[model samples]
Target: MTAISETSAQMALRDPDVRVMLRVRADEPGAFAELVGQYQHRLVAVMHHLIGDATEAEDLAQEAFLRVYRARKKYRPRSKFSTWLFTIANNLARNSLRSRQRKPVTPFVSSESGSMGPHEQMVKDNRSGPMQKVQRKELADLIQEALAALNERQRVAVVLNKFEDMNYAEIAEVMGLTTKGVKSLLSRARMNLRAALAGYVYMDGAPAPEEESERPV
Candidate 1:
């Protein structure tokens, strides 16, 4: 076996999810369902952020899982199971986006039982006041707009980084880019997001009061 495949085999042995997937590949009972239960929410959320339509996202997520099951016989652990799964998702999402001629749709954020989605969580204030809730909603809208402003590749890179908590190397593997390329892609994405959300959000730290005063109304 090649060195890279050998390393991946080691990783497969260590990753519990990979083991579960291997079981599915072997037609073990309930393994496929377990895999879906483990990753369905995460995959749907990622697809939602990528494509911006909740229904379409669900469809895409289901398709991704279907593809995984269909490809089970050929499955080989070249990386973490999540990485392999998301690589499929990323490709599907990209294709869907490309097929549409219109601008990207605004992402829909769903809340359940007063819980916040990732964008809301990021910009939500600690205060429980009504105004704070309004402001949080506004910030969430702006953040979603900012994300939509990024190109498909940049959006994917940022989503995987922020939402998936994947490091540069893992993201590189999923996106078929070199590590350096992923870094550069994220750098540009951050710059674009910061520009899009300039007055409302700070990329590094909170702006000084004086600087805040200078922000456009």
Candidate 2:
């Protein structure tokens, strides 16, 4: 994104969160805490779902907020606060994947220790029974395997499009690519997702029974 004029920046920053950002820009005491209160959970959720690593997701979410704090003085609200927020998150996720290449692929499931850590146990307990938990774990494993199959750029594009609800233009801006390039990336991503979720009813874009009444305009 290019720099904006001061007047335009001020105008755009009129968003309520941007006002809180202005406090951060001014280096107000405890402003960072306020910002964290506002965005931390959201950033963590975005990172976790995008990268599929809960531990690293927390780390990356912290780094994204730190970036926001460090750059606060120069912060211009040309985009929605969320767009800028996720742009930082997406960049960190890419870097994390690069570092991960040095290590082996590890599914989030626990090994033969026959024990789950606190987090794993909590999620496992929510599933219906032993059979359902195992099925859910298997499905999760398959999804991760499919995500691993994507090239980095395509993966980022898919995450932004599917999870973040970013349109082509915002995704292109975040990934630093052209609109046409983003279109191509999403096309490839859809193909990969189709392959990954072949039997899933979601691929057909049908809303589930509970959600049909809440359809968007």
Candidate 3:
């Protein structure tokens, strides 16, 4: 079990939930560690996005997985395993944010590629556009600045939606927010980011409102 055969790993991943989890409860060697390796970075990045301090993010993430490991016996597989796993993450992040004397935030930077800060997938989504090179540098700087300026809840919503590609339910679970609440958070995040990056994205002689209104319409 130290090294799972590819076929075995694929089969395990495809198997029903209870089986894979039961494998974990039984300590079937790689079962537990595999789970850890698969989830660790994403979980940490989610926490880091919410709490903004990498040290605190790491601590909360450790607590989250430890909570998961401790709960293995009681873990009934009612949903996607990631959903349940992130429930623990959600709670831990909320608790950490509430208990802190000061809210924490991660400084955004472009060169560092550990999970793209926020809206990072935008780069890939628009990868081949004519403005790719210019957009990359502009977007990189804008994302870095915009992320730092967001409120915590908005920040988390943006990360989960824009970067994590999590659906509303998953984001709701992660933020301890209602789905509608998550929607509102995301809307505000978008508005704020649009405003923050307006100069970067829309400045370069793109339009003059009076000129366009007079000419086209």
Candidate 4:
């Protein structure tokens, strides 16, 4: 085998998801469904964060899966399966956002009903009374707004880093950026999110004092 194929083989050996995808490539029954079941919620959540519309996010997620299925025959284990999947999702999100820019419509207003991000979990763990529930809902709304305020690339980087828990190298692979570029991108995203959420809450779900200015402006 060629050196690249050897590397691919090594990667496939290292990642079980890649092996599953290889099964998909081989037309193994149920492999594609297994892949979808494993990733559907995550893919949809990432898409929702990217696009800001739950329905559109579902559509994009489905499209991403469709593309993955159609391109299974060309699958190569050059990177982690999740990274490759999100790369496709990122492309679709960018295209959808660009199209929306050309023909603006009323923005979709989605509640944080089914969200299970860090902040949501924090709130869930702390829910003690109706007042706390109200606070949790407000915090969730503020967080969503803060996320929406970020520019597209920054939002993508932040979502991949914070939500997906992807390391810099993985994010770089998914985003088609150098590692340094991913670092810089995440730095800017952090600054933007801090600025957007200043005096409200920290990214770690800690409440920020009204007078706190420790976070970079």
Candidate 5:
């Protein structure tokens, strides 16, 4: 392994999550569980957006944590633990998608439980309209379709940028892309999403307003 620089090591030590990871590396009690508690929901949400399925997303997120725990012995904090974790997640999601493409696709199974699943949860979180004020379920389905229509890399970049609130650099790190490439990927994704959902969903001809990040590329 390459030696970590003193400054880099210090920066890693300063990160709260990195400190927790260090504890995990040392086999400290509760450290891995703490990491899971901190990131489980976020990873599930991100995976849901990537794969368009709640159950699979939950499974994939759990698998990510399992991999993290397995790798704890080799843990090295070069970046925030969240970044490293999501890099694993992003790779897994891509592989899952690719594996799906190679197999005969199965019919989608809707949840039997009465609780709102990830698709509804996502719409309720992102879209501004009250559920009672609109055809919320139908609209949610449309938005989910729009998001799913994006190519895998575009969908990943868009979800990381829009949902995870990751800036271009952070997204680039997770995706193994340059910041400029992330910007362009997201730009194309936004355009594709807009076109796919236009007239059918967002009738105003304006893109859904997203929180602006300062472009670093």
Candidate 6:
């Protein structure tokens, strides 16, 4: 009887799709497509939050896949297959942001009228209310502004933590940071979000009450 190795790569092999990715590495038929089918939506979602444009997010997600395909020969899974995949995503999103900074635009225009963008998705997922009464797109715009107030690194970390539901250690692996560094980054990001959204409607879509003293002025 042979003992199993519990290393990340070995553990990752347990995921059927990761095994497909391994076959992709070996140039097997349809394996790459299988891997892409599994992660395309997720990758695009993360890219949308990071870059704030749906069209661009789709492009970047495709680019990430291309890069992964190209790097297949060198693929060595030191972490979960998704972790490795997102590390590639993280780099592409940051690069896109930096490129965008060279030529500033007004803002991202939603590619469609009715579909929810990344910020709206976050707001709806993180908070709940009788949203039918409010303009969802406008509320999403407000949240997007709050997200914009954070610097690039904070924004990226926040998206990964919140939207991706990744823990600090996992985020560290993705972002190439220590666990403590991730903690500090997320802490500052949350504080900035609070300050930015203060006195506005809360995430749950309720009005924020004003604080006042009974003594009066």
* Top TM-score model: 1
Query: Which model scores highest in lDDT?
Result: 1
Give the Cα error of residue 180 in candidate 2, in Å.
1.6
Winner on lDDT (4 vs 6): 4
Worst 10 residues of 6 by lDDT: 207-216
Using lDDT as the measure, name the better of candidate 3 and candidate 5.
Answer: 5
User: Candidate 5, residues 1-217: lDDT per residue as tens digits?
Assistant: 3355666667777889999888988999999999999999899999998887788999999999999989999988888777899999999999999999999874233333136653454356446543334454655665676677678999899999888889998899999999999989999998988765544443334443431234343
Arrange candidates by lDDT, highest first: which order?
1, 4, 5, 6, 2, 3
> Residue 79 of model 2: what lDDT?
64
lDDT, candidate 6, at 51:
86
TM-score for predicted model 5 compared with the true structure: 0.77
Against the unseen true structure, what C-alpha lDDT does each candidate score? 0.83, 0.74, 0.70, 0.82, 0.79, 0.79
- Per-residue lDDT over 1-217 for candidate 2, one digit per residue giving the tens place of the 0 to 100 score: 3345666566567767777877888889987798799888778877876677788899999999999988998887776677788899998998888788788876544353245443354345435343334455555655655665678898788777877788998899898999999999889887977655554434244664557868775
Sort all candidates by TM-score, best to worst. 1, 4, 6, 5, 2, 3
Candidate 5: C-alpha lDDT = 0.79
Residues 1-217, candidate 4: write the lDDT tens digits: 6897788668766998998999999999999999999999999999999898988999999999999999999988887899999999999999999999899764443445445543454445455432335465666666686788688998899999988999998898888899999999989989987765554544355545643666567
Q: What TM-score does candidate 4 reach?
A: 0.79
RMSD of each: 7.1, 8.1, 9.9, 7.1, 8.3, 7.0
TM-scores of all predicted structures: 0.80, 0.71, 0.66, 0.79, 0.77, 0.78
Give the 10-residue window scoring lowest on summed lDDT in candidate 2: 125-134
Question: What lDDT would candidate 6 get against the real structure?
Answer: 0.79
Query: How much lDDT does candidate 4 score?
Result: 0.82
- Candidates 1 and 5 compared: the better one by TM-score is 1
Candidate 6's displacement at residue 107, Å, is 3.0
Tens digit per residue, CA lDDT, model 6, 1-217: 1233356657777767677778999999899998999899889998988888888999999999999999999986556788888999999998988889999775564433246644555456446542553467755665676786689889889988898888998899899999999999999999988865553445465544543343346
- Candidate 1 structure lDDT: 0.83
lDDT of the structure predicted as candidate 2 = 0.74
Give model 2's TM-score versus the native structure: 0.71
